[model samples]
Target: MPPALNIVPFVSVDHMMRLVLAVGIERFLTELAGFIEEDFRRWSAFDKTPRIASHSPDGVIELMPTSDGTTYGFKYVNGHPKNVRAGRQTVAAFGVLADVGNGYPMLLTEMTILTALRTAATSALAGKYLAPPGARTMALIGNGAQAEFQALAFRALVGVDRLRLYDIDPAATEKCVRNLAGLGFDLRRCASVAAAVEGAEIVTTVTADRQNATILTDNLVGAGLHINGVGGDCPGKTELHPDVLLRCAIFVEYAPQSRIEGEIQQLPPDHPVTELWEVITGRAPGRRDAGQTTLFDSVGFAVEDFSALRYVREKLRTHPFYADLDLLADPDEPRDLFGMLLRAGAGPGRD
Candidate 1:
């Protein structure tokens, strides 16, 4: 029998956790990165746009959408740095993948977890091409919820197991350290951002401040370092100093979006920057020399979310850790929309 057209596979938070555990974190990150890379290599084939955002005083809500001509995907995400104070996540999300031909949703899943994983995976993937050759040490400046995931991904993708960790809140750093214990990481709890960046090959600033904060200053960064600026993703929320941006060779997912939300937002509109797709496709260079400072000013693009949704869809084929949700109205006849509703009302118990 054919599957019901109304059935959409749904991976709830529990199912998402089970799926991640079933696939193992490192393996999941590596495979997800592969999907993201494949999509990036065929960059021109997809429809791309900057995320549509609705900003508020508290935070922002965004819809990130993309399609590769065959399938369409989008993620509904929110960022409220103040939410942590209320015992809620600073970032939360969910996403859907739909068949473009019929406009039917194929999969629905919790992206709060997937977003963290994909974000870290994308950062590590960028690190793979942009970070110095054989680099093993990283300065992770933000020890929030995304910190451990970032550490795991860097190790999985780039073989970086030595981490210098720092956070404005000492407890946050302690949480990150405790979570990563016995994970084969050489972890050091640093006193300040400067201490964290000292002697590190790659520096990752994933802070959660919603203001334009100088997480990484020019004086702290040195030659040949790769900076993964992940936190400064919204306008008025940036991590690196403008002078630091000027000092480095920069790359981004999409120029228009990055200009509005990434660390490059501080730079002029005409500032020379390379797209990561160009580097992955060999159309542009990644790291020119060992001494050149490189930065991947990632603002989290729609295509990455598209790739992640597709990855989850593929895994469901074998893993099957999702529940089938009857999300669509399926009528006995294609045009009997009213009849379908009428029948639903007249089910086992008559009115």
Candidate 2:
């Protein structure tokens, strides 16, 4: 049965967890990546722009939006490194998918978990095309809330099982290790970023800080290694050094957005970069040689959120993981909104 015009499907956090658990996390990520890749292949068909962000001393809040003609979507997300100190999540989000014809919302869901999944999925999807072939070892820096998701997504999509983990706080690293235990990964907790990247073919720098910080220096980055820069997602928040960007053939989700928010923000405005969609679609090259250093400066994009919301909307068809929310006002006569409000106040037998 379909929902009423006034109703929209809402997937709550608990429902989202149940959905992922039911489908299996790795399988969910693998499937979600497929949707993202499908959308990227037709990348030229959608509207694109840099996410709208309002920055503050405490953190940043952003609105990411996109559309592919028939459908439209948007996500509301925030990043506050200090939120964790107050027993809150450092990143939190929610999103909506709507019908373009009527401008009516079709689906609404919490995106905090979804964003983590999509971000990891996007990272691993890039790894599929940009990471060194047969790369099995991955150095995962910044073992925070997103660490385990990134680890799992890589294993599912990129075939990485060996993980070298590190974080500024040892407790966060321990949490990641504990969560990933018995997950068939060869886990090593390294004391430093250099140690974590040592002998690894793919190094992911995902530290959570709002200021310019060098988590990966040029010397630590070796030839032929794929660097997934996940933390440098805002104007001042960066994880890789300028020298590292100069050394690698950089790939990004969207160039305009990445220039403002990705690791490439450190370089000159005219510095060259290949969008990941071009590489995935074979319009551009990725990892030309074995010794080439490739960087996927993954600042989360709106198309990814669009793909994720649509994926969840599709899953809701087979799985009962969502509830119908009365989100729209459907007056009896469409134009009689005030009459509808009057009827509600009239109580029983009002009509």
Candidate 3:
């Protein structure tokens, strides 16, 4: 019999890091943004579903899965704001890419850093359409691990040169500022969310608190401003006031999912919001006027991760350094799955 073939690549966090660094962060974000836009334009071709979530007393865990006929992907992520107190990150994540043809995993990767990168890329992609031209200053309401990436993405993609940073925990803001010190942007630590939003053309709320905290009130929002609502991505966790959502032309990744996780969750089921795919596909208008307020309620969609994974896989083609593991047993015959295990020396009492 021919040698059984079951090959899969184990992509570690380090491999993913090398992939990102090799392409350069800016190029990765730019390419990733393009991939996301392309995927959004073909929204109907994908199998979409809201992530399965498991809630706990401390925080929540979620599994987001999607497929596009050929490939399937899923991410396992946890959100625990209190984890930092235990010297852990507020979010921990990993994901897998699988071939839909035979239901075999092709790659497994740590997505903690990749998630951060994809979130920032998604935000910047939305901002490209929703934010007014010449947008320079951004008010970042929550300064956490995501803050620096958001800052860098905006600077690289949206011409953002100034950042007004604020967090309930001053240490988080300090960490963000320290991370961006040599990146060459003007930074200001704000005393309050309102102070941070003042005079800024873009406002990004990525707070970690898992509650109905109103980070952006209606009154604080200015004309012609774009708001990137990155926090409050789960049910019962909201960051924008109802009036703020009403005042802006809201653009979301996926409306059905966004209505449950984005800031639009505050509104009724019938509340009006534009899907980013519509804008990307030219089915809907974006930024009608310079004076109109725009909002991109970002909940970190699965398609963005799909795009990121595809981009990473393509990058690995040139500089391959991933492990191949036997995650699935292969038999010469398709119906011999059980027989393959037996052939692998799986007798009862055999070690």
Candidate 4:
């Protein structure tokens, strides 16, 4: 194999957006979910941990790291809901993939867009396993940067084509509606969360807030609904009322981690919850019956980020959105690192 320090493949924000458009966002999501499922099937092979976070009054910065023996990956992400008032995205992220054998960085990519894509794909994938079969509609409570991605992912993966949306800021809802208007979804702008969830088989709460906000209460949630709670990710931040969790069959990406960052934080430590991987692997049941209510408490995980990075690495082989980044110093004598820089300065134009 070639030396690992020679070059790194870097996928920037513009490149990521171009790649998403080139591959078509829906298709990309569908493919990315396939990758996520494949990794989940062999979940035992990975070295995992709950993301390490530093919380503050403004937002939270997190580091998610994991390894599968041969390869390793981690993401740096931050969430600040107040950023929107200053015309900034509420979340920004980037990730790295490295060869575990050599401990050398291999890929670095902008993950803000990729994170949105994987999150939606994972939600839709969980829906496929948790939602009622032939479910055709979903209520998206937070219509922000992630709303459209969730809408398209559901439409592509769960066969959902109708969306009911509600956001405190009408402009956010308007942006979501405008973005997805002609995407074939039967869009409904609801006056309230209850209105959005009415007659909908699946409800996705993706609001961005930094508190224990009850975006969904027991009264709003009816039987047979699959709820995708996406935003209650940091400590002291949650969406559903405790009663809603008590009523639904909860599913999570990773138990130890989800219990800390997901909706289950409200429940007792030993509260019954199912792992989504078991459902994917057929080791556990997903939806028991047509009238069953299921909740996928997703706070995002490192394994999903690893899988996403792997997918992008494979794509870089054919697609050209990646750049060769000189991330590490390459020395002719391997140990003569100082000599290499000296040789460069010793060239014709040297001082």
lDDT of each prediction vs. the true structure?
Answer: 0.94, 0.94, 0.88, 0.92
Ten contiguous residues with the weakest lDDT in model 2: 342-351
Give one digit per residue, the lDDT tens place, for model 4 in 161-212: 9899999999999999999987898999999998999989999999987779
- lDDT tens digits by residue: candidate 2, 210-276: 7899999889999999999998988888999899999999999999989988999999999999999
Tell me the RMSD of model 1 versus the true structure: 1.3
RMSD of 3: 2.6
TM-score of 2: 0.97
Query: For model 3, how does the per-residue alpha-carbon lDDT over 58-125 read when each residue is reduced to its tens digit?
Result: 88899999988898999999988899889998899988888899787887878898899999999999
Give candidate 4's TM-score: 0.97
In candidate 4, stretches whose alpha carbon ends up further than 4 angstroms from where it belongs are 1-4, 348-351
Q: Using lDDT as the measure, name the better of candidate 3 and candidate 4.
A: 4
- What lDDT would candidate 4 get against the real structure? 0.92
Per-residue alpha-carbon lDDT of candidate 1 for residues 201-294, written as tens digits (9 for 90 to 100): 9999999888899999899999999999999898888999999999999999999889988998899999999999999999999999999999
Better of 2 and 3 by lDDT: 2
